[model samples]
Target: MDLASQIYERKSCRNYLDEEIDLDIIKDFISKCRPLNENINYYYEILTKDEVSVRTPWSAPYYLALYSEEKENYFENIGFVFQQVSLFLQSIGIGSCWVGMASPKKKKSNFVILIAFGKSEKMTRDRSSFKRKDLSKISDYEDERLVPAQLAPSAINSQPWFFKHSKDGFDVYQKKQNILKRQVFKNWNPIDMGIALAHLYVENEETFDFEIKNDFEELKGHTYTGSIKI
Candidate 1:
């Protein structure tokens, strides 16, 4: 499958087989990742399991450690950038899972998140396996384009993304979570938004353009993330 098809087929894989992967293909793909928020400074390193320390019980042979300067939308930028890499990994039949509870053993102040990747039998999911909200639940109205975004994986499935459509494009937001959810996934929400947007980008590669705009109408109880024309 091509990159766009990977969006639909990709699964957040946890269970894996004892298999090997070619790192050179991953290295080349990482070099070419197109950042959704290009203004933010970010970097990543693919490290072995020995280099990472995890709070989760599951493990992988390799982990992709993402780091970025703590600036506006840094986490979001990291998500948008590396999620593309995740899709690329999927295209190559490698499996990966976003490891929010993990970090490098020698963690830097700039460290953001880890994506644990290895060869797995469960690389793709049937559409029935995808437990996602309908388009009406995520957007203000019907839009088939939002289907891929609907399928995006989020931390604990707290799919906190909202879109308000307009004639020009659509404005995206991070839906506000209550105190209970916020305590657990406050940082993950923005990254989730970026991951959702990454799916839209993969689907509409030629026309995806994102920018922060001040003029869009306010979305009640939601924080403005960005606007996109695609």
Candidate 2:
């Protein structure tokens, strides 16, 4: 399936079937793509058998452990890259959840994120409501069209970010906040924005026949600064 369909078809699958995924499945997926940034790597690493822990029953047999040494941008990258992985898994009929609320098994890195993978337990439509915003609500008509940017995922579903149109393409930005991060919450907003860019560009290309050109630029009232053009 295309990335945009994958993005829209993807949902947070908290309830998974009691199924285990082959290690090779995840390994092959990660091995194929290199992350855009070097300070961090984006792929699922097999933790020790003990690395899998949870209060509730986990659906997918495998859980991916996200790790990074970058103090300010690790989680951002996790959010960014994992979103892509999440959608990819969905494309293949695998269920996943961005398991930030669960207790992580490893503690060696400055930041960490996790996603539970498995076959999903079927649910009614009412139980699967992931109400996303429309194109008009996220940006103004003159505002470089940020409709696709709203598809991004954030901490506890708190998509704390913003977007602005630039002379070049579109500038994806974040909102600065004094909110506290647990020792585990090493800031990952920039990387998340990068993943967000992936979704925006992918969806735009498939649906609108547009492509994004990345050009770094600075803007006010936004967190990290990046751009992609059509």
Candidate 3:
């Protein structure tokens, strides 16, 4: 299937079979996976259940642990890189889910996120099965280009991104976190923005120049994250 098809068909799988993935295939995927930013230092390890601590009830036989040297846009970098891995796994029939609620008990580096992957009981989902905010709700301009971005996954399905048309392309922002939610999601929201960016990149191979402009006016409850020039 094509990349667009993979974006629409991929779904998070919570239940996984107790089977080991082929080491060769895993290595090949690692070699082929691309990161959004090449300048940052990031590391990943394929781990078994015994190597990590997960408080959630969902379980998978194999997990991919991601770590990065703390730097600017580190969380977003993690999301950008792993979302590629997630989409690739779905494209090849392996099941994967972003395990943000879980963490490694032993810290070798700055653990950013974990992905659980293995044989899943159910492999794919129809495009209509996606539970996402409508395009009208997510974007200021009426363009199909933003549809894939609307479907980008987030922690607690927050769907925290907003977009407005600009002369060159678009300006991206994150919804202002209310007091009740800020304490829990301050870090995860930027990661969600990165996931949306990955979807946008897959939809259109355009260059994006990220910047923070506090003076840029935004929707009533949103804050500026960055911009993309088409």
Candidate 4:
């Protein structure tokens, strides 16, 4: 299926069978995802553990962790890189979830994205049941479609973003309400925001060009979050 359809059909998979992904499969997956930045790519590595202990929102059999050593914006790179892996897994009939908080005992891995494999399970409504605000409510478009921005994943699916539009383009900003801190991985709000921006850009590649706004204030507070034009 196409990327747009994959985005729509992709749901967080939290169940896995008693199976192991071959080392070759993992390598092949990475081969497909040539990193955009060489430096950031060098700082990240994918690790897997069979005996992983996880708590809330996850019941998958096995877990995968992407390890990063960068001090700043490393976790964000984790989100950005793993999103690609998760989408690739989905394309190959696998399921995944952003399990950053699920694995509490992980080392050198602050962010954990869960993937559920094997047979497909029953589809259920998302726990949030919160209605997706229409494009009219969150965007400035006359033709209403679920703007891919709404589909961007958050730290815990909190979806912490607000919208502002102008003659040039629209802006996405992060809200600092009820923010949660990561134990091992620091600096994720902006990183996740960047991941969300990547999704929005991939989904709307032809529509606009993404530009990183130099807002010193938003960048100052670690809790503050949001996106700018693209």
lDDT of 3 by residue, 1-230 (tens): 35657788788899899987786776676676556567779888988888889988978888899888887677877887778777778877789988877877678758788888998979788888888888888888567878878888898999999899877778888898899899878888988888888777766654645554555765688877777754
Q: Rate the local accuracy (lDDT) of all candidates.
A: 0.87, 0.57, 0.80, 0.52
lDDT value, residue 66 of candidate 3: 88
Question: After superposing candidate 3, which stretches have Cα over 4 Å from the reference?
Answer: 206-220
Worst 10 residues of 2 by lDDT: 206-215
Tens-place lDDT digits, model 2, residues 82-175: 6667777777777777665554565554446667777775422331365655554444343434544566655555454565556755555665
lDDT for residue 115 in candidate 1, whole number 0-100? 95
Better of 2 and 3 by TM-score: 3
Ranking by lDDT: 1, 3, 2, 4
Candidate 3 positional error at 64, Å = 1.0
Among residues 3 or more apart in sequence or in different chains, the pairs in candidate 2 whose N, CA or C atoms overlap within 3 Å are 20-61, 60-117, 60-118, 75-188, 76-188, 76-192, 174-223, 213-229
Cα error, candidate 2, residue 209 (Å): 16
What is the RMSD, in Å, between candidate 2 and the native fold over all Cα?
A: 4.7
CA RMSD (A), model 1: 1.1
lDDT of model number 3: 0.80
Worst 10 residues of 4 by lDDT: 216-225
Candidate 1 residue-wise lDDT, 74-120, digit = tens: 77888888888889889888999999999999868788889999999
What is the Cα-based lDDT of residue 148 in candidate 2?
49
lDDT-wise, the better of 1 and 3 is 1
Per-prediction TM-score to the true structure, in the order listed: 0.97, 0.73, 0.89, 0.68
